[model samples]
Target chain A: MIAAGLDPIAQFELHKIQELKLGPIDISFTNSSLMMVFTVALIGLWLLLSTRKAALVPGRAQSIAEMSYEFIADMIRSTAGKDGLRFFPFVFSLFIFILFANLLGMIPFFFTTTSHIIVTFTFAMMVIGLVVVYGVWKNGFGFLKLFWPAGVPAVLKILLVTPLEIISFLSRPISLSVRLWANMFAGHILLKLFAGFMIMMVSAFGVFKGGLAALIPFSLTLALTPLEFLVAFVQAYVFALLTCVYLSDALHPGHH
Target chain B: MTYLFDMFGYGFAAAASAAETVADYKGDQDGGAAFPPFDPTYFPSQIFWLLVTFFVLYFMLSRIFLPRIGSMIEERSNRIADDLDMASRLQLQAEQAQSSYEQELADARAKAHNIGATTRASVEAEIAKDVEAADVEADRQQAGADARIATIRNQALKNIDKVAADVAAEIVEKIGGFTPNTATVKTAVG
Candidate 1:
């Protein structure tokens, strides 16, 4: 059997550190939970320490903190309008959590919390849930106007457009979750796979010829690391951007 | 070519082994073999922990971190705006001061030019008046001197005629040894 270190899938394996059961449910703390807690602590401490001074002329750490704040604020303001600034806390939390989780996962042997479909799906579900709740709260029956777009003939609206809109609306959470999970999941796997290839080549052929052959996969792995970093950041950005877009619908439904 | 085929075969074999390991690992769990991500066994624990941590993060961020960071940003922007306002106001004040300084300089220059022109005109007028008075005094003194000289010359001419008449009467008396008539002598002298 190959060492677990060489197994790409082993990175995702969960081991219970503290086993707890509630009736029939197993709610044990796992590596994924540790990673989540670490992500939260890191975010909290960074923000807290950075703004401890809160000087008008920001220091380096303060500048970084402020830039992140403005980045998310501007994002919401532009996508969701001035009214959407209300969701600043919610969006900010999601962006920072995902961003830190993805970055921390890049470290060797660190569990990637966001790599799990369940975790990403939970965030996606929360986003869509907020949309539905806020939309109904704000617009009431008018929120249904999102499905019934303007300028469509009544026949086509009932037959084609409304159904399509509802289906697309339902698919929002699924797409949002999968897009993030797939990127992190595939990127890490690819990196591991190439690294595995290099090792396999060196072992299969003697170090002399095998190492020469391994160079190809080695270079490929080297190239993919930076690309994975980019993906990590981009996925976080896309998730937050889409969250804003969905929330914008809640803010103003039926107005494209 | 055979070596290349060998490499391909080994790559597939490695993949097959990795898949088998994954299956073995899954089989060790209580439920039937399933993908790790799709494994229902860990779902309840993941959801529970996810809820706990996410809410903790959300509260920490929304209640604490976000507000602190947001206010700092807002305050910094406000400070910048205030500084800009003050700078523009100071610039306006400086511009006003410079214009007023220029105005005062222009006024002083014009005043100096007016003083020079007036002084030149007054001095010229005084010089012209002095020259005219000197000319009139010289003319008056020459006229007075000419009248006195003419008077003195007329007195000397009258005395010379009287003296000539007296000398002729004395010579006649001495040679004739008789006194001539006084009226005749007078008429001769006249």
Candidate 2:
């Protein structure tokens, strides 16, 4: 495909196994699904080894496991407040999954499940739906009252209030899903593009000119790699923060 | 699909407004959701395992670990409070005992001083009585001795006169009749 000039996107095409069938459903394993299983197994093995023996003082692996636990716990406590304790499992799972997926994608052959919109969107939708549904369940129909401002003038209420609330509500999934998916997608593509550029530049322009041309893309890729690393962390934090906010809204839905 | 695009358009508009704040353009890629050839069926088994994992962790922490720690803290606090109270009570008892000891000591000292004074006064009076008795006895002895010495002196004097008179009488008889009554002659010459 690369030789045929089929574009970089096609070079990264994901195809499902059409041959495999499971009962009525065509459930065949894809790269993304395989990555999920691999991530789960890795986490299980890590935790199993880390917590095989309870220690008064933690060893290196145990300390890492403990730190990971405490880190997510602290994140939830700070962002979601005291009520965050109830959602520890969900939030921890999300953090571990995303953190591993992003880090794993940095490896050459590993697929990042988070890089796919469907997966990210599904995760986001579940969290957001939980927020809305649980908010309504907890607060009754008063959850919808979160959209309405209490002190607005009666005349401007319909004009001003409706659109803001709609936009805000709609922006939740867009922002949540897009943030993770876009970052992963962009980072991976940029790396591939730079690699392609290095190959093309070095070949098209001979040693002297190629070396000079190589420096630009080479430096850019170098700069972007660290930036991508930073983006991975930031996306995780933002995703967790959004979950926190949504959960907060569920617990206490309104300012006014 | 069309609704999704309209939603995207609205999102793009919002994104455009936010673009002034910062660049929101991440170049286009084919990362959007596609209908995969694989089944998108939910796994009931996976859901069952997930729930089991959540409940096990929750119960273990809540029932087992947290309760033990809570009780341990309670026990420690109770023990500390009991120790402090016991120490305070013991200190108070010790102070009371010390105070009584000091009071008894002062009382004993006062009683001893009074006893010493009375004993000293009695001893001094007995000594004065003994000295008075001895002075009386000595005066009496001196008077008796004076009297005996006077008597003895008088007797000796008498004997000496008598002998002198007799001698005088003998001498007078020999010489002439001058030896008259010696007593009368001695008396008349004296």
Candidate 3:
């Protein structure tokens, strides 16, 4: 059995694959691949179950489904406009998948797929790729004009403006990936660390003194559990929100 | 990097034994590593769902749902406006009718007042004429009554004087012892 207080970084490293091999280019499932499949199945089953009988007077499950639907729908509409209505399904799906994955990690002995940088970076790249493609599709070559604002002094544009735009553009994937991975990574580590503290105190002090010392960390862990849950939800929201903002830039390329 | 090597030591050991056990699982044998290397290339689950969800929502809203809702709202707004206009016209008509009725009432009241004043003046004039006629009739009747009473008193006094004269004649005859000569004549004349 894996010991408690094992290094958090070591846990991550254990999961990481150091090399790749070519095989029957057809169908072999790895851990990450399995996780991807599970996420898809989860999303499909969730929607299918939730919307089976979409009651006008929503039942508890239906209410949750509708709230989720509206949450992401309004999010897209607000950030991306009525035109962004087209993007709602994609954004909403993303929100649900991430939300479920984050929530799933809260269960004991479950893998948090989003805790890895590779998984997060891949999602970030997909979103960024979509934005670029959609922007170009919607606005044509005029999409390049997004990097250049009108009415700028000619000299200053080369020195200051171009680099800033490029950096800002490149920063999207970095920010997106890091935001999700870091939050999940830190949160899980914190929970593990606190739990370790609680155990250590209770064992070291014995039933009377140890139990009393254990209570402090126990209570603290309890407090942080809900906070971690909140963080999970928040990270999901941030991911979706940034996606919408990126999509908006694509949809309306000329706007700053 | 060192940490990665340390962490994977156990997994590698486990994989090597598992490889010997199962020849069917043959892909990892070619690589020095017993297991597959971590490929960051896989697209996360979020991408697939995001695409699916966006398309479904887009189709549902743009094609089937929003248009119906928008039309309903527009219809309701129009209905409310029509109702308000109807109410306003009805109110205006009611006000006009009320004013007309009030005006008619005022006119009737003025006419009634005029008629009452004229009737009162006519009645006063008639009363004054009747009183004057009554006073004249009373004066005529009193004058006639006074005339008849004065004639009756004069006749009574004459009759009384004639009777006293006759009595005096009889007394004279008896005392002188001579027969008294009598004549048939009205006492009043005598």
In model 1, the clashing pairs are: none
At residue A121, give the lDDT of candidate 1. 92
Q: What are the clash counts of all predictions, listed in order? A: 0, 1, 7
Q: List the per-model TM-score of the A chain.
A: 0.96, 0.87, 0.87
Of the pair 2 and 3, which is ahead by TM-score? 2
**Which has the higher lDDT value, candidate number 1 or candidate number 3?**
1
Write down the TM-score of every candidate: 0.77, 0.60, 0.57
- Higher DockQ: candidate 1 or 3? 1
Per-residue lDDT for A1-256 in model 2, tens only? 1433413343234555333454765445555556666776676667667666545455887668666666766777776678866776667667666777778877766766676666677778768988888888888988876777577886676788867877888889878887676667666667766766877787789888998999988998889788767666666766766787778777766653
* Deviation from native of the Cα of residue A201 in model 3, angstroms: 3.1
Model 3 per-residue lDDT tens digits across residues B1-190 = 3533332343345334433423422332343332211323333323343344445544544454334333443555677889899999999999999999999999999999999999999999999989989989888998898888888888888777677667655665678665455453233226
**Best model number under TM-score:** 1
Better of 2 and 3 by DockQ: 2
Q: Write the per-residue lDDT of candidate 1 for residues B1-190, one digit (tens) a residue.
A: 4643443343345445545645766665544556776567888888888889989999998888888887777787888999999999999999999999999999999999999999999998888888888878877887787777778778767766666556656767898776767667667887
